[model samples]
Target: MITLFGVGCLVFLVVCALVVARTRDLLAATVVFAAYSLVMALVWQQLQSPDVAITEAALGAGITSLLFLLAIGRTRRTEDEEG
Candidate 1:
């Protein structure tokens, strides 16, 4: 029997992917993208690749999300000024 935690994580990953695709706000999408990283890390842990999973958590959930949010912040000003 598949653990519910595993199933929920898998479902969450799919949902996050869809959220990222459908979200209109850049900040919201970046947050969902970060959620995708976290879900991927959980999947990696389930697969026994703790090292890779840790790296993904740091890069995908941490660094990449911060970078995207920062970029969005920078660009928001430009968009606002133009509009």
Candidate 2:
């Protein structure tokens, strides 16, 4: 019994994943990845798993994304220094 809302979310998830994979810009990709995490959290919530959703929102969307941004900043600094 897959509803339209579920299908829409799945489509959006796939689209975001594709964008993240295809984009060359690290910052843009990171933002898209965060969006993908949020979509995943929403899917988990819809599936009746509040715990998983909250964990995904906190870790996946929040902490992991922040780490990635920080790493990207470091890499960019190193590249700028080298160049």
Candidate 3:
């Protein structure tokens, strides 16, 4: 049963990756990419890999996201529509 769950998470991760790829909005794509990392981290935790989970949380969910957001700052934002 757990194997099925792991498989499902893998499939969902793939879908999230596709979503990130297909999105034209940089911010939206970044958010989707973060979701992909978070889900992957959970999957790793469930598979008895706490070290991977911690690394994913610290790097994937934290530093990587901050860096991506910083990079995405070069793009226009919804708030800019008012100007």
Candidate 2 regions with alpha-carbon error over 4 angstroms: 77-83
List the candidate 1 regions with Cα displacement exceeding 4 Å: 77-83
**Sort order, lDDT high to low:** 2, 1, 3
Ranking by TM-score, best first? 2, 1, 3
Model 2 agreement with the true structure over 1-83: per-residue lDDT tens digits: 67889899999999999998776778888999999999999999889999999999999999999999999988852223233
Each model's RMSD to truth, in Å? Answer: 3.6, 3.9, 5.0
The best candidate in terms of lDDT = 2
lDDT (tens digit, per residue) of candidate 3 on 1-83? 48888888999999999988766677887788888899899998998999999999889978898898997786564334344
Residue clash pairs of candidate 2: none
**Which has the higher TM-score value, candidate number 1 or candidate number 2?**
2
Q: Which candidate is the best by TM-score?
A: 2
Q: Against the hidden reference, what TM-scores do the models get?
A: 0.84, 0.87, 0.78
Which 10-residue span in candidate 1 carries the lowest summed lDDT? 74-83
